[model samples]
Target chain A: MKLEKIRPSEITPEHVYLSRRRVLRIGALALGTAALSACGLPSPSPEPTQTNPRVPKDLPTDKRDEFGDPANRWEEITNYNNFYEFTMDKQEVARLAQNFKTSPWTVTVGGLVNRPRTYDLDDLRKFGEEERIYRLRCVEGWSMVIPWLGFPLHKLLREVEPLSKARYVRFESLFDPDQMPGQRLSFYPWPYAEGLRLDEAMHDLTLLVTGLYGHPLPPQNGAPVRLAVPWKYGFKSIKSIVRIDLVEEQPATLWNTVAPHEYGFYSNVNPNKPHPRWSQATERRIGEPGRRRTLMFNGYERQVAALYAGMDLMKNY
Target chain B: MRVWLRAHGLQALVHIGALIPLGVMIADYAQDRLTVNPIQELTLRTGKVALVLLVLSLACTPLNTLFGFRGALRVRRALGLYGFLYVVLHLLVFTVLDYVGDLALIVQTVLEKYYIVAGLAAFVLLVPLAVTSTRGWQRRLGQRWRALHRLVYLAVPLAVLHFALLVKSLVGRPEPLLWGALVLGLLALRIPAVRRAVARWRDRVRHTTSEWRVANRKWRMANSK
Candidate 1:
């Protein structure tokens, strides 16, 4: 209750003595460093850049590396989400997902696959650690550069190869109203689902991301499983996946079902094709000062451009 | 005011629990768990709770009449104060922190948006009621007290209409419309003409539903025996 009652007179002489001692200690450290330099021991080097400059995702320079490299503060993860069933309130999912059942997660691989197998999260993790740095573009026109640690969908697909008939891979999230309260909201069609072209699914860049920034994904950030398509808008990367089905026909996505004009099945993050309501080219980097411009195919044109070679992105979007 | 304080001392403590959501929400914003403008979420959330308490306050009287519970009005005074407190906070937050002295935008909201206008109207109506709620004022005003308090009937529906119009066009939204319809239905039940019509309709329904009750009673007696 007395929060604003700070009195300068309360500071004793001993406190001033301690403050002086700290400055003296810092001065001694400076002298010691200079002396060490004179003795031929190397001076400490400045911190290296946070991101791996070689990686394509690191090309964007106007960003704040508040999380440091490979260990992002969990803030960005909780805030940036597309759990549409949770009333389109991005933070609501993360706040509301504490009650979600992440354990006992088993991905059922079925449909046109030769071997339809149910793999627990442990089974998937057994394949081991592989980190891929990627840029995630939200359909709402924001972006983040994240280093996601996970295995490729192709790696999993090879274990249970899709038949020649397979043209698309459909992923479904878990659906238990008791566990996921978003299901209670009558607005969203729960058991959120997303689809990917077989070619896109097979692409080296496409991943079934289990971790971000070298840490296991938090429950809110889609614990057991989530899709990570580096080239597409983040909405296409559905979270809390339970089933993956390979189909002959191109599959529909939840957003396209709700608003065909607003969201497209091929919601690839092409900066040139603006979303109807907002500009897609310019994006607010999550932890940065300036709004950085987005890139074509989220700056992965070389890797993913060929997949949509002849198609007009604007029309498709 | 003194009577209210004495009567609601315990109730005040219980209703203060409503402030927890605001604190938790602000904490989330500070923690960056929510990307929304913090002030915006807080304002909307407080306003929403205020509207809920207001609606719930009104529902008590009618609900008592329908359910034969006479003591329900005991809670209305405290609940009404909670609504008044939250509404004041909601309005203050909007005019002060949210606008940050942008007089033009504030004026624009007061003028352009019918919902904000209605909300402002409701708050303006509540001020005199809240001030005159004291026993002293009641005694002073005498017969005029009833006239002053009757404004609540108008304020409640206007507030709901504000919410309904405010939320109508939001993407994938229907909650406000449902609540609006519910308030409209409740208000309709209070009008003498509409009340009589509904009584006829409801009496028929009670008769129909009561038939199942007699059958269930007989089934229960047979099963027990």
Candidate 2:
């Protein structure tokens, strides 16, 4: 029944039809693969962001280094690392912290405060912004010229009535393992907390920063909320905070508790005393201007110097 | 002595491979491209490659037994040599780059980091195995050679640990777990019972693939014709 109308030529044509179909199928597949360059395809893309910040010479400048080298875009932006709450590894802190939704974030202020309160991000913003140029020294012996945009910590403290018994302010990072994977490993004592002496907590130089490099803090750089203690090593600048417990005793710090010799509570950038391994006198600038000499109290001696007066910094360190 | 030179030559080539990265790293440092912690990255990369090569190198022994790839015997030496070569490179990068060859820093790292201790122990174990891989050393050691080589099994897990600590956060990417699985799978397959079981499975998979290929070929030819 199938061959009723087919001639000998037509029979060969049907056979040829199958062969042509096969050829067409192969040709289509080849073309499809060529179009896709195979599913496991290769092509051009931006080189992995060796993302050093680059600022034009014309960009308005405020902060400069010890050498009086003007801070460029990278120094201001790229160098202000957020390896605090999550991982100390800069790249991993950036990568692993993508899921941290800064919305609904509220800094729960408790402890010595006479009026305990939870200030959501929006309410905190009403406090306004001030751009303070300061040097940020890292525990790993790197530094950056950061013109931080945030209100003074003194202003934030004024909001809540203090408990007279409270002598130190302890800050805690958001502790969800789902969001902060660095907590999974003992990278830094999980939940990444820090505290300040009462006088130090009320210092004018201390900052509750929400932005840096003139923009809202990128999620990796601790968006919405973080502490910015310019005089101390970068670790003191806790990121993605959730709690602030004012205490009578010096609350345990992650580094000082873990390795006391290397990380002292008085982690003021002292050029005189070296870290357990490396010299503290210098730090890599982490931008176009390259490395520069570190300064005493990260060059904030004029504003924060009175706080550390007469104490043996090396002994405290 | 020529055999000695040949063995050393193989290691030298690997050393050169290891050093090329070092040269690039130094160039990066000079050019202001290297990160603040260049040593950490280099050590992690070297350790990673060492472990992968260790698995790939160990794979040769199993494959030789399974498919009867007799030529793999000569190649196995090179593969094992490459593993040892990479491990030594990993160690060197840690010592020179991380600690700047500081004895004090080395002791601090060993005490502070269990992972570093694991890596140090692994490297220490691999030293004798690498030296004894040579025919002269093997003949010299005799029965002791077999005992020494068995240490490779323990070294693999210690090496795995060396890889794990570098994982700052395993939130989204579970590549570390997969790596752990592969290492564990390979080690488990060495058990006599597991070996017999895997042999049967391998034969089945081999038979299935061959038949599938035949079916595919026939269909293609018929359509073409």
Candidate 3:
């Protein structure tokens, strides 16, 4: 079914729209009067300044995945998170992670690589950045459209130069219990880890995200650095990286290790493959009132489907 | 005031306590504090309250059976009905608010999701119990009324299982298991042997208490003389 293009005005709730419009009008009137008196010239258009100012206009962003759906508000994207390292409660993660320290963080890259090195946050940023508006579909049957700012994972892989035998890229999050209280839970295997096939890691759509909505990543949203694999379920995009390893065999992931049947190793978002406990056929879009049909490979089928050409996703899942 | 409290206070407390969660949910909705997914928040909150009330209702019989707390029987019906009310609300939110009353989708979910099926079965079983909870129906059904209400023993466990299966990480979370344990303990108290033993213990305790009371009264009368 086709979803009618939702205009920006329709996206904002009525009360929020009215309040923001009033504030904008008052600000414009003041600016207009000042500009007229100062130089007898008309005030510059307020359109650019009034809209989302966090995301710079010049940043290159792909709009293909949006399909006319507007990006979720910054608050919705940041506040509603599934970083289990912080907490299981999605809304409480933001508040609990308010004091989390992300500075002085280093990600160690090794295992089946020629130029093994540990890069700090600054060193990682030197590879360059671009903005991509991607749909993040969680296995919990919820989704969000986020404008993420980061370079492709291929760039980092090229710099590291993986060995010929390296078959998988394993990612690990920080294991500090003092900072991340959720890590103290003995039930969960701490130091959250995830893995992707070497070729999948080299895909251009796979991002090593550092920011979102044109702002640096918040603590709850995987500050310092995180991975964003648009096609896979959100949990596959491991957060708060502290280690990276290239292995010959598939590495064990936290979710897969905990519950292999429910969360498969290749957690590509396939609506046909329903979760053991729930359906993946539809997802509730964050900030929206109703559910929407989930797309195959989260609507990145064109870019990533070729990667899984011969293999059956159901078995892999 | 003390006499009036003894007569009516426990019932009043039960009524108020059962409705507090609903009040909190409404307050949260009005204040926009239901988090990002308000429908999900409503669904989880209502479901949780329903389960809690149902468990509390189940505990009432054991309370009366073991300790001879006759007051426990007075609020049992109210607790069960309140639980039924929340279950209705929970299903309403799931149907109207969450699914927009999409019959096909709701039916599909009910068939496909085991948790939904379990919850639906629990709700189905509670309907007859809630309907016949009145004294008039109790009189009409006679001995059959007792047998009908025993369906609660089955319904409570199904509800607990529904909760346990609904969570994404049931292995890591012990809440559903804890609730299961509580239900099992309450069920165990219903066994005839256990009930008889508890009754005998209660009788012995009552006999000793009355003896002590008479002796204390006699001592007080002597001191006054």
What are the DockQ scores of the candidates, in order?
0.06, 0.05, 0.56
Ten contiguous residues minimizing lDDT sum, candidate 1 chain B: B33-42
Put down candidate 1 lDDT per residue, B34-141, tens digits, no spaces: 453345466778888888888877777766665555545666666777788889888877777655556765674476557787888998898898898777998999
Point out where model 2 deviates above 4 Å: A1-80, A83-89, A92-151, A163-200, A203-205, A210-219, A223-225, A230-236, A240-317, B1-33, B69-74, B135-146, B165-177, B204-225
Model 1 docking grade: incorrect
Question: Cα lDDT of all candidates, in order?
Answer: 0.69, 0.67, 0.84
Model 3 chain B weakest lDDT span, ten residues long: B165-174
Clash-forming residue pairs, model 3: none
Q: For model 1, name the residue pairs that clash.
A: none
Q: Indicate the DockQ of the complex predicted as candidate 1.
A: 0.06
Best model per DockQ = 3
lDDT of 2 by residue, B1-225 (tens): 798866565455545654565477568768855554455456666676677777766666677766766555556666667778878888787667545577764675476656677778888888888888999988998999877887888887778766665443344345677777887887777788988888998899999999999999999999999
TM-score of each: 0.52, 0.58, 0.85
In TM-score terms, candidate 1 sits at 0.52
lDDT of 1 by residue, A184-297 (tens): 876666678899999999998888987655445655777668989978888888888999999988787777887787688988887666454334665655554334567788
Which sequence of candidate numbers ranks them by lDDT, best first? 3, 1, 2
Residue A166 in candidate 3, Cα distance off native in Å? 1.3
Error of 1 at A212 (Å): 2.6
Reported per model, the fraction of native interface contacts reproduced equals 0.06, 0.03, 0.69
Interface RMSD of 1: 7.9
Candidate by candidate, in order, the iRMS in Å equals 7.9, 7.9, 1.4
What does the TM-score come to for chain B in model 2?
0.74
